[model samples]
Each structure stands twice: as structure tokens, then as C-alpha cells.
Target: MDTRPRRRRWPIVAAGVAAFTASAAIFSQIAFAATLFSDNFEDGDLGGWSKSGGTWAVVSDGSKALNQSNSGSENAREFAGDTGWTNYTVSARVKPTSLPGNGLAGLLARAKSSTTFYRLALVPGGVQLQAVNSGSVTVLGQVSRTVSTGTWYTLSLTVSGSTISGAVDGASVGSGSSSVASSGRIGVQTAYAAASFDDVTVSDTAGPAPTTTGPTPTKSPTPTKSPTPTPTSGGGGSTPTGSWPSSTGSVSVSGTIKVSGSLDGGMKRYCCIGDGSQSESQDPMFELADGATLKNVIIGSPAGDGVHCLGRCTIQNVWWEDVGEDAATFLGTSGGDSYVIGGGARSASDKVFQHNGNGTVHISGFYASDIGKLYRGCGNCTNHYERHVTVDNVLLNKAKYVVGINTNWGDTATLTRVVVQSSSGIHVCAEYTGVAKGSEPKYLGDGMGDGHCNFTSSDITYK
Candidate 1:
């Protein structure tokens, strides 16, 4: 009599095996097969690394090297089991030093179980590529410059076949292509900042190379009408109008198309349409094989001010209730990546992300009830770039005057297992002249009422 559905157990701390032939004599002459983990904060053998519950510190890098600190500000640095390989390639050299707002250094790939993972951070301001499945967080890439706090920087990641390329000191910024599940296990992430990782390596390559960029030429221009308006047998349905395939032009649809209407201002209500007006071919909605899902949708009014998603789209289990002002907006002039898995929105007054120039908005398993504000760029709006908003397993109930989750701009939001019982649970408007001012929303989570939660947001980090 086991009716299933009862699995939420977490508590496994086992990571003490650093004997790779004694650091393989210090990187074994570095050529390919590599592995090295350190923390001279005191003891040695952190080879299998483990320290994620409370006061974390391996400090003591005044000379001999080995660091990880968090005296009182919440901490994290996990490295569970080693999910093996599927065309691997991981490298590190980090050095994050005095971090408080730009603190994060990375390399956590394919980690399927231990709450899932796929990070690649290195922040000072630049290089970041995340993917913490199951538990949320899905920022695929970032590279706005900043990367020089205490020195050292040589991060590298390579997951062949489904893409996932990354390189820092050597060059190559970020790359993506995922089937969603490749192979897992691999860690080393730092959040309250304070970093110093050296050598560390993981092997296996030859994967990544399977897109000749062929067939994908339709040029979109057919919708003279038919935006989906013929379901009378279904009572409440009637708000289908179409016309958008002119600007940069791009519209792809492989299947699934069910729009009950409600997207007048967000402009044309596209289930698939690109050319929002060139920030790199604006309006882009791509879902090739086994991708593309939008149900009971509504993105009311958005004519020449928002909505831009370049490639790779996913808006599953949808429902954007009454989105008129701004319910979904993500712009990337020369960069791209947008994903919104599982949706639910109520009122959207003006901010959900306005002038996102660089591009990146990942809201996992979302549920926004009364959002009047939640943004990245509103300061009069310009080319405004740099954004990586990840809200996994979210639930923002009754958000009156909400603002914090990644305010101001330069964005990098990550809230796992989130639950903002908002009267106002996060507000930040300091940068571009108070953007649009809307304060009195601060709640970092500790109310502990079993909303099934997790938190991360001095900027975000909880690998």
C-alpha cells in the first residue's frame, strides 16, 4: 500500500577522499586528465570537498593558498559525488576576494541528484552560466566585463554534444545547447564570495558539433488572420488577433498552439514571431523539437516598449491572467536566452523587466499573483543590458508594491525553492536614479512556515 508521492528527504554529507595519488604530484604536468582541490584554511584533504551547512570557512590563504570564507552572512560551497562524464571538460583558477555584491566563483556541472546542478560562475561582474535543475535556477550565460577582484581568473567548461561551452581567461564567453539531461556530478561554487580555487580539472570531450544550420527558412508572412479563433464549443474564449512578422522577421512553430487570447499591448500576441525591431532581430520565439508550450495565455498591451526573446523558448503550464502593462519582457540587443517554465500571473502594472539589453530571464515554476513591480531596467530605458533572473519554484502571493529580486539593473537574481509571502518581500531601487521608486518590500526568508523554501540573493548563489 504505497500510493507513491512522498519524497523530500535531504541530508547526505560524505566527501572526504582526496588521494588522487597525492594531488597526482601537483597537476601531473597538466596536459589533459586533471584534478586538484585545496583549502589551506587549516586541514588539507578537501579533495572530496564538503562544507555547506552554516559557518563555512577553510580560510588561511595569506601565503600557502586555500580559501573559502563566510564568518556571518550565510555561506555555501558544495561538491557532492561526481556525476561522472558525458563529454566532460571542467577547469578553474578563480580568485574572488572582497566580494559582497559581486561574489561568486564556479564550476558545477551536470550534477543530476544532490538537488541538481550545472553552474559555471566567476563573477566580479562577468562570466556566469548556470543550470540548477529540479531545484530551479537556469541562467545560461553572462559576460558583461567585470572579472578582476583579487586577481587570478582562468575558468573553463566544456560539455560536448549538447553544447555547453565556456571560457574565461582564454576567451570564449558562453555557449548553450541542451537536451536537458546529459550526464551529472561535478562541483565547486562560492557565494558570499571570498574565493581561491586552483588547477582543479575534469576531463572527456569530443562532443559538441551537430548543427549545420540548415532547414529553417519560412520567412513568416502568412498570418493575415487566424490567430486562433474558432473554439466556440469552449465557452469563455474570444480574443484572437494576429499581425507581427515585419521588423527583423522570425516565426517558428512545430506543433502545440492554444491561445485563448489577451495580449494587446505586449504587441501582437505571438505564439511565435520575431523582429521586435532589431536589438538583434527582436521578436524571437523558437521551439523546434519537443519545445514550445503556452496555455491560457494573456500578455495585454505592449506595442513598442517590451517583449523580446531570441531563441530557445519554453513557457509551459501557462496562464498570464491580466497582463496589460508589463507581464513578460526580456530584451537582448546582442545576446540572448529566455525561458519561463510553468507560469501564472495576475496584474502587471509596469515592471517585470523593461529594457533588458544584454538578455537573460529565466523564471522557473513561477507564480506571480499581484506584481506591480519586479524589474531590471526602467531608468528611462536605453540599451540597458546584463540580466540573469532565476526564480525557481516561485510563489509571490499578493505582491502589493514589490521591487527586490534583482532591482536597479546589472541583474543576477537567483531564488531557489522560493516563497515570497509578499506584502512587499524585496525592493531595491538605487542605481539609475531610483528607476521608478517603490520601496518597503524586504523578506529574505526564515519565516519557516513550510512553504518548501530556499534563499539566495545578496545577488544570488546557493549551488
Candidate 2:
């Protein structure tokens, strides 16, 4: 049986993050450097970040950073990650600019709320690690050391199963066991203090040498896969806010890079491939072998052929700066599954996804803009396969058509929570008549059909 797409709503992450874009916004989960989320707040806007009981904005403190500027708000808090983040490290540069005598500037992990989380905080008398639940606080570990108001300190907090550990400026502050909150969001907090935070980042820190952590940087660095499989539910501990992200850095690809296990780009821009014009001979920048997984990568302009999957694969939290020939192509025929989750694509002069294989392609919590087609089932491929796709919680920004399918081949597309951001009138599902390899596919009418498109007008929303 096919699984219904699960909707994920997380916070505004950095460019390095997998879901939404912000500072570093490098998103992926599993092991060391598998950055699931980060934000420098350089974009000067908090698009996907959530706030509670605080006055917050992007303020320059050395550089762009999220700052809570209200000392009177006793429980000022801001979140920039998913509620499903578990077994990860959340770190940030924190400066207590206006702390009261007993106020605290803290970094939070497994934050279920503004007051509920495991915290590594700088207090007046010292540093403390505590578990706070429903506004109630319990100290798990503490170290006595005075902190300077104007000085910056690196606060690092790691949560694994029941073990919680924290550090300050590379120095161990505390480690202990706690069950207060096992899994939640990542954020920054202040209690009776105003502070500036920067370079906020979350990376995978548990599971052995992280050998299988993710992308060992081989071939050039030869990448490795994390022993941990990303939950089919969440990739970067965050949900996208339906906007494009900035690139923290860029990688030039000379040729197609083959991925055998998994490759997490940590949300870097991979470009230098082809021209923006449609060309059939353009090589893909990355190719995934059967069962391979690609995460937290941004495909920049001239994006040859975005990504190709030979068999079962997962495209998690990947953004396309510009759509190439196609954003991603699924060529798997093994009746396995492929997923496109939590990312956005823009300036797609063509289709965003091409399905030329068997089995199902599930896309959930995704954003698309100015595209010819968000998804297309192979219309004239040599092999006749029954393809299926389920799209849920997606924002279609001025999209021409949501999905195009070959009705003759028995292709099916299911759409839900599709927010259409344009009055241009998009085709929810456009049907086509498959032809031979040499002929063009014929276009058919669109609407909910018995077996082709399984959705009603209620499944779509106009904005």
C-alpha cells in the first residue's frame, strides 16, 4: 500500500539547511556535519522562523544575526527548526548585550516550546544546563563562571536519546540524562535579558565516527552514507516557508558525480554545468545509484540535468536555483519508491520533475514557481509503466501546470493541500495520450478522473 504524504511544517532555516533557507541552512540528519538547519539571518527577514513572547529581528552584531531586543520580556524565544529533530547538535554564537542581574542567554535543543526544552544558558553566577517543561525549570547540570556582557561565546548542545550534553566556547559545561523533552525544535531563548545570536547551526552529532554520517567528501573527498536512515517524515528538522534560500557557498561540477550510498551537500549551490536553454545532451551534475539518497543540495543555474535516480532513491530538501532540462529524473523500474520532500524550485523554464520509471514518486511540503510543469510522467518512453505520484502540502507559485501524465499508460497523480499562488489558472492535473518514441505526446483534458487524477476542487486552494 502507498503511504499518504505527511505534511511537515518547520521554521526558517539557513541556506545550509535542507528545508527553508537562512544563514547556513544546511539541512540533513543522521551523523556528523549532517547539518539539518542553521541561520545567520543575513537575508534581513524571518520568513520561516517562529517567535513567541519576544521582540525579534535581523540585527547587525558584527554581521547579520537574529536578536531579541526586549529585556523586559521574561520568556522571549524564537524557533528556527523542526519539532521532529532528535539526536543532533545545535550550536550558535551568543552575546548577552543587555542581561539583567539574574537574566540568561541560552541556546536550546529539543525545544517543544519557548519554555520547554533542554537549555545551555549563561546565567549571572555561572553556566547551567537545565530541562524546562511547561514553564517549570529543573537544573540538570551547572558550572560556576562569570560571563562578560559584551563578550561572545560559542554554545553547543547535543541531544541523543536520553543523554544531553552541552559546552561553552569548546569547554565542557555539563552532561546529564533527562527525559523532559526527547524530540522537538531548535531555537534561542532569553529570560529577562536581551541578546544577539549569530551563526546558529544544527548538525548530526551521534552514531559512531559518523563514518556513515553522510558524504565523506570523496571522489574529490569520496562520500559515505550515514547508518541512520532519514525518517520518511522529516529530513532537516525543519519545514519550508515556501520561499527560495540564499546559497552559503557554491560548488562547480565539471561532470556527473555518481552517488552510491548517500550525499548530503549541506545546502551548497552546485553549478557550472550547462546553459539555461533546453539541451538534450547536458549531463547531470549528480547521479544516484539504486537506493541512493541525496539531501540538502541546491542546483544552480545552467543546472544541466538536475539529478537522476537509477532505482529507489530519495530527493530530500533539495532546492533548484534554476531548473535545468528537468530538476530531477526518476528512471527506477524496480517498483520501489522515490520521494521529493521539503524544498523549492524556481525559474524552471521546463518541468521540475520527470518520472520515466515504475513505482511511486511522493512529493510533500514542496514549493514551486514559474514552472512549465511541476511533474511529468514519461509520456513516450520505450517502456510502458504504470507511474504514480502523490503531492501534498505544496505551494505552487505561478505554476503553469501542477502535474502532467500519460493517461494511456495508466499514470495516476493525487494532489492535496495545493496552494495556488497565482490567478493565472493552473491545471491541477493535465492528461496526455502517450505516443511512440518518435511522435509527440497528445494533450488531453484535465480534472478529477476516476483513476488518473484522484483529487477534487477542495484539494486545491487559490491564493
In order of appearance, the predictions have TM-scores of: 0.26, 0.50
lDDT of 1 by residue, 1-463 (tens): 3232221222222242244556757875544332322222233345455443223444445433446665232325555334445666766677877566636767776654333456778765677665654434555656667677688887777777677767777776556666555876566667656676655555544435222221222232122111212122321122111111122222233322332222212212333333222243243232112122243333332222223333323444344434444544544453344566554556665555443444445665566666665544443344333344445565655554323332222234445555555445344222222133344323342311111112334422222
Worst 10 residues of 2 by lDDT: 214-223
What digit string (tens of lDDT, one per residue) describes model 2 on residues 300-398? 888888898998788888898788689899998766568887888888877999998876788888988888899999888887666778788888888
* Maximum-lDDT candidate: 2
Least accurate 10 contiguous residues by lDDT in model 1: 235-244
Query: Which runs of model 2 end up more than 4 angstroms from their true locations?
Result: 1-230, 233-239
Please report the TM-score between candidate 1 and the true structure.
Answer: 0.26
True lDDT of residue 382, candidate 1:
41
